[model samples]
Target: MTSKIKGLKHIIYDLSRINEWWLISAGFVLFAFLPYTFMHHGRVLDIEMFRILFTDPAVYIALLIVFSAQIFLFASNDYFDRDVDALDPGKRVRNPVCDGRVTLAGVRALLIVTAIIPLIASLYFGLLAFLFSALAMFIFYYYTAPPLRFKNKVFLDVLSHGLFVNTFPYFFCLVALMDFTVGTVFLLFAIMMRSTMAQMLQEIRDYHIDSQVEKNTVVVLGQKRAIWVVFSVYIVLFTVTTCLMLSYELFGWGIPMYYSIILILAISYIPIFRKLLKAKDYNREIERLWMGQGRTNRWQVAQYFASFSIYFILVIFLIITGYS
Candidate 1:
């Protein structure tokens, strides 16, 4: 019995790390709160909007599906990339599966279970939700699958990750609300751009392993050029997104508070931009310096927090302005 219990505990730990359950949970919260926050503005704790946000069955169900989809995708990635992950110098120590604590079969089983839940939810949600969910799964599969394994295709690899991982979830949320406006699409595009650039930066960090595997944008573009490309992409995304928000605010299409939120995000990128500019080389040591692994982790945490906070604030504003 004790042996069985130990096995169970190990399974749970493996699941937690492989599926990155915490990160998926964070993504779900971010998705659930984006519309709620925008509708309520900054006052997330308000009773009226809060009640509406929580009580809506469709919204809640959609969020659950999104969360499940993300979990499934994460697990599937770990299962497929176990070998590559074992080769990753920076991630080996932290990877649960790489350490052999979790069998690939266990991860595959978890993926199936996670995938089923979202699939059922999507079927009930409507065609748009179902379509996006299916697309998300397809993207994940193709990202790791052979023949068209886009994850190993340089620029397309980063693009696929950004679109499927970040923008798709955001789109799922909007689709749930039945808000398929051009503005929403443009917003998703901006998100895709930002996410792609961020992934590119991560590729720069993983340049060595990527080169070994011959599987990423940084490997194909070369480290120096890839870093510059990431910087350029960030600048363009920031500029375009800012202009769009300003136009929306000026035309009375969106609340001015979104502008403030965008400004905050822009400020958040300052350190990353500075590091890119000052970094002297693209080798391991230089990569370590610019990657600022600790700083990157902190920045990511901050970005997630900012994303939720901005959405919450926007929702409150929307409620006050009677947009809700």
Candidate 2:
């Protein structure tokens, strides 16, 4: 009985993956709040929505589904990458299953429990939300799982990552809660393009290690191509920013000084983009660039979401104060 209790404790902790859960939760909040901001921007933003959200069982349920999805994703990633991780000294020490702290059967049970809850909870949102949830879970599960593991397929790999990781989570939460429009689709497009760039950065970050492996299976597009792809996506993002400002009354920014803020963030990436494009020595430049950046590739993704969140909050404050 004591051993069973200990096993249960470990399973709970391992599956929580708390740091990643919180980070993704931040994205969820950012995405979920977008519709609220747009819908109430010119009008006095309601404090009542906050109260209702706090009291709403559905909000809690959605959060639980997201939490479960994170657990399933990261834990399953560890399980599927166990062999690869076991090859690395650091990862082998960190992975519970790989380190013998958890068994394969324990992992199987963890996967099943975590996977089922989201599908069940999503039903409360409606059949469309349920279908979206299923698709999200399927992509999450298969990204690293066997038989058409999408993680190893070059263009499809980053595309899938963008879809399941960024846009779908944002899309479903909005679909579950509010009426959406073309502006919403544009927001989703921006989110996806940024997500793909981040995943591309991850590919660049992991490329050296993956290439070092004796029998290489890395399908990340070569770093040179990825750099150009990121640049291309960067252009699309600028276009989206323009369209967003033109098409929507963002937070009652009738005169969108907010566009400047986005442009500031967008411009910061350009120095590196130009450097990578012009670099004469590819290998040395990439090593130096990745080493110098210091921030995680995913940091940029969170950064964008966070900026939008602040924009949302700022507008609400303005409206509440009659500044808008």
Candidate 2 structure lDDT? 0.68
Worst 10 residues of 2 by lDDT: 212-221
Candidate that would win on lDDT? 2
lDDT, each prediction: 0.67, 0.68
Once fitted onto the true fold, the runs of candidate 1 whose alpha carbons sit more than 4 angstroms away are 1-46, 249-255, 281-296, 299-324
Residue 16 in candidate 2 has what lDDT? 59
| lDDT for each residue of candidate 1 in 232-295, tens digit (9 for 90 to 100) | 8778877776776677667866424543454577667777578666776544433453344522
State candidate 2's TM-score: 0.75
lDDT of 2 by residue, 119-144 (tens): 99999989988888888889988888
Best by TM-score: 1
Per-prediction count of colliding residue pairs?
14, 0
- Tell me which residue pairs clash in candidate 2: none
**Candidate 2 off by > 4 Å:** 1-10, 37-42, 89-94, 209-220, 246-264, 268-324
Model 1 gets an lDDT of 0.67
